[model samples]
Target: MQPAFTRERVGVHAADMVHGITAVTDAWQPGRTVDVSAAMQSVTARVTARTLFSTSIGDQDVTDIQHCLVVLFSGVYRRMTAPLGLWEKLPTPGNRRFRAAHDRLRGLIHRIVRTHRRTADAHDDLLTALAAAHGDGPGDSLSDRELCDQVMTLLVAGTEPTGHALAWAVHLIATHPEVEARLHAETDRVLAGRRLPELADLPRLEYTGRVFTEVLRLYPPGWMFTRTTTCETELAGRALPRGADVLYSPYALHRDPRLFAEPGIFDPDRWHPDRARSVPRGAFIPFGAGNRKCIGEHFGTVEALLALSTLCARWRLRPVPGAEVRPRPETTLGTGPLPMLAHPRAPG
Candidate 1:
C-alpha cells in the first residue's frame, strides 16, 4: 500500500531564515530577485544538505545535488512522453546527465555516511540518523542502496516543488498587495513582534497559512499529480478500471466551478475558517490526497510562511522592468523564463 500524505518538517524552510537569507541581507542584498531561481536552488540545497549530509557535504556538494535535480526535473516531461525504446537509449544526453548526477549525489551521501562513522557523535542530521540506523537493524534498517534511494528521493522531492513554491510565493504575494497587506496584518498580529515564528507559532498563523492555501489554489507547485488505480472503483459513480492511469489534477480541479464557487477567482477569504472547514476533503487537492499525499506539507508551509514574512517585512515587490509574471504550466507550476519585477519596498 502507498504511504499516506502527512506533514513533514522540511529541513531547509526553518533553517534558511538563519543560514541563507540573513547572510544575503547582511552582505549581499540585491534590490531584486535577479537570481531568484538561484536563490530557490540555494534554499533547497541547504535543506537537502542539512537533511542528509549533515556535517559531511558542503556547499559545492549541494550544487552538484542541485544539478542532478535539474537533470531529472528537466527530463521528467520528456520521459513521460518519449517512446520507450527511444527513451531507453541510455546514451541520450539527458539520461547521461541523470546518470552523472545520480552518481555524484550517491557519492556525496556515502562520503557523509563515512564521515559520520568516524565522528560517532550523536548527530541530529537526517543522514547521520539514517547512517547509524536509528530505530532497528536489517529488517528495519535501511540498506546502503536504500540509503541511496532515500537520499535520491529526498533530493528530488525536498528541492524541486519547494524551490518552485518559494519562488511563486514571492511572486503571488508581491503582485497582490491587498493580499499582501492582509498577510502582513495576520503575521504581525499573530506573531506580535515575538522572537521569530517557530513550529509553535504555526497554528497561530492561520490566515497567513490560508495565503498559502489560496496560492496553492491559483498556482500550486505540484500542478499535475498522478496515480495508477489498483482496484476497480467508482468515483462520482463513474467506473474506474483497475490498472488504469488516474490523472487527478489539482490545477484543473481547483478551477472547476462545480467544485468551487467562482472557481476562477483568487480569493483568500474563500479559505476563511468557515469556508475552509467546509471544503470537501478532495475539492482542492494541490498537495494531493489519500495514501500518496505530500509528506512535506507542514514543512513546506512553515518554510513559506517564514520566508514570506521575512521578505515582506523587508521589501515590497513591484513589477521589474521588462518583466511580467507569466505562468509556465510545466510538470510543476512556475513563473515563466522571465521573472516578475520585484523591487523591494522601503521598510516602513
Candidate 2:
C-alpha cells in the first residue's frame, strides 16, 4: 500500500508542492522578518493535506484540523514526562483542551473520509488509494475507522517532521553564508533560469542535497526512538533481560565526537561522497532503521529538496538579528518561531 502510492504517485503531487511553497516564499518582502518556522509548518501541512487528502490549504476545514493538531500536541511533553499517567485522563484544563482538540480532529478526518467515499473519483492521492483498496477486496480491506486512523497518522506524521526539518535547514542556510553560497551555486547552475526543479535535477544538486543531509543529521525531528528486546540478549558482553526497553538517541549519536569529527558544527561538506561513507555503522538514523522506518521518508525528502531548491534559487533568507533560536523538543523536536529576513537573489 505504501510503495504503490508513495513512490508512484508522489510526482503527481510534486508540481503542486512546488507551487505551494513558491507562493509562500514569493509573498515575503525583502528586509522584513518572517517567521520561517511557522511558514515551513504551513507549507508542509498544506502540501501533505493536498497530496494525502486532497484538502485545500485555504479551506476552513484544513484550518480547523491544523488548529486542532496544535492543541493536541501541545500537551505531548507533559504526557510523556507525567509519572502516573493520571494527568491525561483527568479533566484538567490542559487535558480538557486536548480532549476537545482530539475530538475536533477526529470529526474532521471522519468527515473527509465520508466526503471521499461519496465524491471520490480517479484522483491520485493517498486517501483515494486507501479508499479504493478498502473497496477492492473483502476481508483484507481496511475498516472505516482504520481508514480514518491511517489518514490522521499520515497527515500528522508527514507534516510535522518535514516542517521542522525544513525550518532547521532554512535556519542553517541563513546562518552559514559559505554553505548558502555553494547551495545557490549548484541550484543556479542546474536550474539555468528554469522555474521549477525536476526529479532529474536532484542528482546534480549535490550541495543542496548535502545541506539537507547535514541538517537532518544535526536536527533530526525524530531525535530518539525506543526498542524492546523480545528475548534475553547480550550486548557488549553485558546481559539484558527480555522486555527491556532500550532507548537510542540519534541526536546524541549524530553529535558524538567519537563518531563525527567536530560534530557540533554545521558542515554540509562532511557529507561529500568520499567523507560521508567513512561514518561508522548505526551512527546515523534520522528517519529510523529497520521495517518500522518512516513510510513517507522518500516523499518528505523530495518535498524538502524541492522546497529548498525552488526558494533558495530566488530568495535568500537571513536570520533576524537577536532572535532567540532554540529547539522546542516535544513529541517531535522542533524550532520555535525562527524569524528570518528574506532578500531577493540576483538572477545568475
Candidate 3:
C-alpha cells in the first residue's frame, strides 16, 4: 500500500489534479457562492479513483460511490460511540441504511476487484498491486473477501481525509488574506507560469508548504485516534492492563499552549524553518506516528500542495456571508457544504 503511493507513482496523477481543479474554476462566477466542501470532495474523489484504479468510471458510478460514502460516514460515529455495539444490530432505519450502505460499498469494491483481475492492465496503481497480492497463490494469496476489504479501506481512507484537508486549507487561506498573499507570491515565484505544479517544485514553494502544515496543525482530519496496549504497562503513573483502549486527540494536543505559542491562532509563520524544530517530538502528528501512520501521507501531501498552488495561483475562495461554517466531527473532523464565493485573479 505504501509503495503504491511513492512520489513517482503519485506524480503520475498530477495532470488529473490539474484538470479537476480547472473544472471547478471554470464553473466559478463572481459573487456566486458554491459549496466548497462538495467541490473539494469531487476533485479529491476523481483524483483518488483515477489514481487508485487508473480506469474510467462513468459519472453514474462516481455518483453511486459518493452516495454510499455519505451514508456510511453518517452512521459510523454513532456506531462507534454506542455501548457494546448494541445500536448496530437494532435494525432501525438508520441502522438498516448503514448496513445497506456498507453492503453496497463492499459489493461494489468486490466487483471492481474481480473486473480488475479479468481485464485491468499492468498499471502503476493501488488496484494493480492488490491484484498481484491476490494472485500470490495458495496460503500467501489474499482471498477475494480480503482483497475487497483492502480496496474499501484504501478508498475510504484515501478520499475523505484528503478532501477535508484541502477544503479546510482553502477555508483558512480565504479567512487569512495576509497568509493568502504570501502563498500567492510564493506560487508565482516558484511556478513562474506553469500550467500545473510539479513534484520537484514542492520544495521551492516553502510558504505554500507551511500554509498546509499550519492547516493540518489547526484542523487535522484524523482528529482522534485510538491505540491499545499490547501487554500490561505503566505510563507516567497510571497502570494499563493488556488490551486497554487509549484515545489520543490531535485536535486537543495541537492547541496545547505548552507546545505552541498562542495556540488558538492560525499562524503559518510558526512553521518556519528555525521555529518548527523547537516543538516537542510527539506534539505535531498530523499524519500520525510510527509504523501505523497513514500510508497515503505522501500521496495526500502532494495532492493538497498541488491543488493549493494550482488553484491559489488563479482564484481566491472567500466564505459566504452568514453561512454556518463550523467543524462537524465524525470519522474525520469535517464541515458540511461550506459555501464560498470565488473571485478570479489575474494570471501570473
Candidate 4:
C-alpha cells in the first residue's frame, strides 16, 4: 500500500483528479452560490473511486457512500467519548442507524472486491494490485475478507479527510484577500496558458503546496487520535501502565504558540524551510507518526495541490457575505456548510 502511494505512483492519478475538479467547477456559474464543502466532497469521492477502482461511481452511489460515512464516523466518535461504555450496547436509534450504515458499506465493498477478483486484469488501479498480490507463504496473501476490509479503510480514509482539507483550504483562501491574491498570482503564472494542472507542474506550484501544508496544520481532518501503551512507560514525570489509552490532538498541537509564532494566523510562509526547521520533529503530525502514519499522505497532498491549482487558475471563489462558516469536528474536522460565489478569472 505504501508503495502504491509513493510520489511517482500517485502522479498516475493526477488525470482523475483534474477530471473531477473540472466537472465540479464547470457547474459553477458566475455569482451562483455553491456549498463548497459538498462540492469538494463530491469531487474527492469521484476522484477516489476512479483512482482506487478505475471506474466512475454513479452520483447516487457517491451520495450514499457520503451519508453512510457520516453516520458511521459520528456514531463511532459518540461511542468512544460516551461516559458509560454500556451506552453503546443499547438498541437506540443511533445504534440502529450505525449498524445499517456499517452493513451497507461492508456489503458494497464485498461486492466490489468480488467483481474486481473476477476481472482483475482489466483494471490498473489499487483494487487490481490487491487482487493480484502474491506472497511466499500460505495465508500471506490477503483473503477476500481482508481485501474488503482494506478497501473499506482506504475508501473511507481517502475520501473524507482529503475532501474536508480541500474545503478548509478554499474557505481560508476566500476569507483572506491577501492569501487569495497571492494564490491567484502563483497559479496564473505557473499554469500559464493551461486550463488544468498536471503532475509535471506541481514542482513549480511551491506556494500552492505551502498553502496546502498550512491548511492541514490549521484543520487536519484527523484532528485527534488515540494510542495505547504496549508496555509501562513514564512521560513528563507521570507513570502510565501498559494498555493505557492516550489521546493527542493535531488541532491543539498545531496551534501551540511555543511551537509556532502567531499560531492563530493563517500564514503559509511559516512553512519556509528555515522557519519550519525551528519546530521540533514530533510537533507536526497532521498524518500521525511512526508506523501508524497514513499511507495516503502523499497521494492526498498531490490531489489537493492539483485541485487547488486548477481551481485558482480559472476562478476565484469568495465566501457569501453573512454566511457563517464554522468547523464541525466529528470523526474528521469538517466545514458544515460553506457557501461561496465563484467568479471567473481572465486567463494569464
Highest-TM-score candidate: 3
| Cα lDDT tens digits for candidate 4, 248-277 | 999999999888889889999988787888
Give the Å error, residue 145, model 3.
1.8
Sorted by TM-score, highest first, which candidate order results? Answer: 3, 2, 4, 1
lDDT of 3 by residue, 34-120 (tens): 888888877777777777667635556666777787787778889778999887889799988988989988887777778777775
Question: What ordering of candidates by lDDT runs from best to worst?
Answer: 4, 2, 3, 1
TM-scores, all models, native as reference: 0.83, 0.92, 0.92, 0.91
Off by over 4 Å in 4: 56-64, 83-100, 134-136
Q: Give residue 313's lDDT in candidate 3 (0 to 100).
A: 77
lDDT for position 193 in model 1: 65
Counting clashing residue pairs in each candidate, in order, gives: 4, 0, 0, 0
Q: Each candidate: RMSD to true structure?
A: 3.8, 2.4, 2.2, 2.3
* Candidate 3, superposed: residue stretches over 4 Å from native: 90-93, 134-139
Give candidate 1 misplaced runs (Cα > 4 Å). 1-13, 16-18, 21-33, 88-96, 117-121, 132-140, 186-197, 236-238, 338-347
Q: Write the per-residue lDDT of candidate 1 for residues 1-348, one digit (tens) a residue.
A: 012112433533366534544433334344544546556655766665665565566777766666667767777767667787587467877688767766776787777666676775756566655655645554777667777777777767767777777777767676688888877776667657653556556677777777777888877888887788889988877998998787767888888887778876768789887887867778887778877787767666666677666655555555566675666777677674434444544333
- Looking at model 1, the pairs that clash are 3-291, 316-345, 319-341, 320-341
Could you tell me which 10 consecutive residues in candidate 4 have the lowest summed lDDT?
Answer: 55-64
